[model samples]
Target: MVVDDDPEIVNLVHIYLTNDGYNVIPVYNGNEALSVISHHRVDLVILDIMMPDIDGMEVCRKIRKDNVVPIIMLSAKTEDMDKIQGLMTGADDYMIKPFNPMELLARMKSLLRRFHLFTQQDGDNSSHKDDVVQINDLKINKDYHEVTYRDSLIDLTAKEFDILYLLANHPGKVYSAEDIFNLVWNEPNPSNNTVMAHISNLREKMERAAGYKMIKTVWGVGYKIDQ
Candidate 1:
């Protein structure tokens, strides 16, 4: 997602990314970015700071509540505080105005690599054990990065699959959002709604497919799967 009010900026990025053999989604504004993300799969976001509706900071914050997608904030506000705020708001990286396209591409590549590694690390850690974990009618195949319910395929993002496998692998064990985030993201982001949001999304999918929720939320404690 390349979000900016300027068409030229978006076009430049789209061209560079496309030339690198990457799929580019050119979003003209923050709202469009959010809408597109909700509907499509977005690996990363290059967001501009200033816009008429829903600036980059607010977009970053909103996205943080639900997603761990890599975000790079582009801003003309060359202030230390601005950069700090962007990072605190869930942006993975920040860039000043008139940024070098090559540098941006390098940073994007770095973040993408890190994000993928972090999301898939749990499966690697349990390599010595069976990667496939089946709980009742739900089956998670970490080796293939796939999930199935009642033998039907259930599509999921990489993070969603990680969180699901983490819980289903240990039936009856409760894990707080902080624990899940740290274990899955490999980053200590406690007290944020990111984990909750992911759980909610995952739960909905399970219910819709299986006609019942497989994940149990323990109020005040965390989430678990009944044995």
Candidate 2:
């Protein structure tokens, strides 16, 4: 799905993506995009930051409230803060305006591929031993991509679950922001703030459920699951 107020940009992306054999859904505004998403199984979203009615950031936040769908944001703003804000709002990737069509296509492919793998990893429950990891009262079922705290199920987005699983799988091993981004996202050069946002979001959910701290940040190092 491509959500952009600019018809030209939407058309360009739609044309190229359609040619690449993707079923593209193009929306001119954020509301339309949300409406469509509410009823459809959208794999990914390419959203514009500036729009009429609801902007991309709000749309991203709304979607992140319940959906873990990968979102790539587009904007003319080149500032690092803009990119960080977009990531903080739950965007999987960010693209500046005047971006290369081929580059966007490449990024779309990478995001889709990684997302597919993430979802696929949850299949085949017969191999539960390799898929499920337990630390204290928290149990992570990778086959189901689910988490449970003290025998109670905890709802988590795909990205959030992946981050938790990565840390809990290693227990006490600290992982830098770059390491987490590369391992979970399968993409490089994302801002550390992006990883920080995800970690903060994940920690909030887990801590709220567990009634205690789960992830610990090592000063000047990174993060690890509390053991």
Candidate 3:
């Protein structure tokens, strides 16, 4: 899916992606993109930051609340802060305006390939069980994608679950932000703030459920599921 207010850019992306054998869905606004995304299974989203009605960041946040679909942000703003803001809002990748079509295609292919690998890993490990991970009173069910604290269920988004699963699967292992980003977002590389925001969000949700913190930050590195 491609969400951009500029018809020319949208058309250009659509033509390029369709030629690359992808079924492209192009929408002119973020709201329309949201509506379409809710009803469809999109492999990835190319979202423009500035738009009428709802902006891309809000749309990205909304999508991240439940969906783990890869998002590549498009923006005219070249500032490092703007890029950081986009990634913090849940974009898997970012591209400044006037990007090469070939580069865009390359990024799309890389993201999709990683996504494929993640799904394959899930299927392969479907039956391998540590079933439950218990750190104090917090419990994470690997197979069911459920988290519980003292027997109370905790609602988590797909990204949150992925983060928890990664950490819990290897207790005491410190994962750098880049590693976490690749594992959760299925990108070859991802912005540090993207990993940080998701981890912070996950911790907040977990803390609310458990009444205490379970995930620990590893200073100068990333995070770890302290055993």
Candidate 4:
């Protein structure tokens, strides 16, 4: 799925993706994109940050609530914070405007390829069950796909869930942001902001649920779910 306010860019992207053998779905605004996504299954989303109604970040947040579908944000704003904000809001990648259509295609291919390979690796054992993982007051039930801290359920997006799962599964192991991205997002090379944003959101949720911070930031490194 592609969401952008500019028809020219949309058309160009569509043409390029079509040539790459992808079935492209294009929407002119964030609302329309959300509507389409609610009704259809999409492997990846290429979203423009600037749009009428809701904007890309909100859309990304909504999508992340239940779906782990990868998202690549396209934006005219090249500010470091803008990129960081996009990634924090659940975008899997960020691309500035005037980017090459070929690069977009390559990114899409790379993300999709990684997604497929990871799913394949998980195989039939990936089904969620009711096993509860407890670390102090933080509780995560893999079967129910639920996380709770101090007895309150934490509302986490799919991306957040995957990140937490990876960290909590290996509590003491400090995973680099790149490692988290490659393993959870299936991206060969993911943006630093993408990892940062998701980790920030995850920390927020964990803090809200546990009433204290459980994910400890390793200076100049990544994060770890403190045991």
Per-prediction TM-score to the true structure, in the order listed: 0.57, 0.89, 0.75, 0.75
lDDT of 3 by residue, 53-123 (tens): 99999999998877778789999999877887776677767899988988999988877765554444355
Clashes of 1: 0
Off by over 4 Å in 4: 114-162, 177-193
lDDT for each residue of candidate 2 in 1-227, tens digit (9 for 90 to 100): 99999999999999999999999998999999999999999999999999989999999999988787888999999998898788778787789999999999998898777666656664455777987899988999776667898889886656777789999999999999989988887776756877887788788888899888789999899999867
Report how far residue 189 has shifted in candidate 3, in Å: 7.7
lDDT of 3: 0.81
List candidate 2 stretches off by more than 4 Å: 121-123, 151-157, 188-190
Worst 10 residues of 3 by lDDT: 115-124
lDDT of 1 by residue, 1-227 (tens): 99999999999999999999899999888889889998999999999999999999899878866676888889999877777667656566678999999989997887687557535645355572477788878888766666888889886645567788889889999999889978776654353466765677678778899898788888999999986
Which scores better on TM-score, 1 or 4? 4
* Residue 176 local lDDT, model 1: 90
lDDT of 4 by residue, 70-163 (tens): 7899999989899989878877678999899988888777767655543443334445332456788777776556677777877665567778
lDDT of each: 0.80, 0.86, 0.81, 0.81
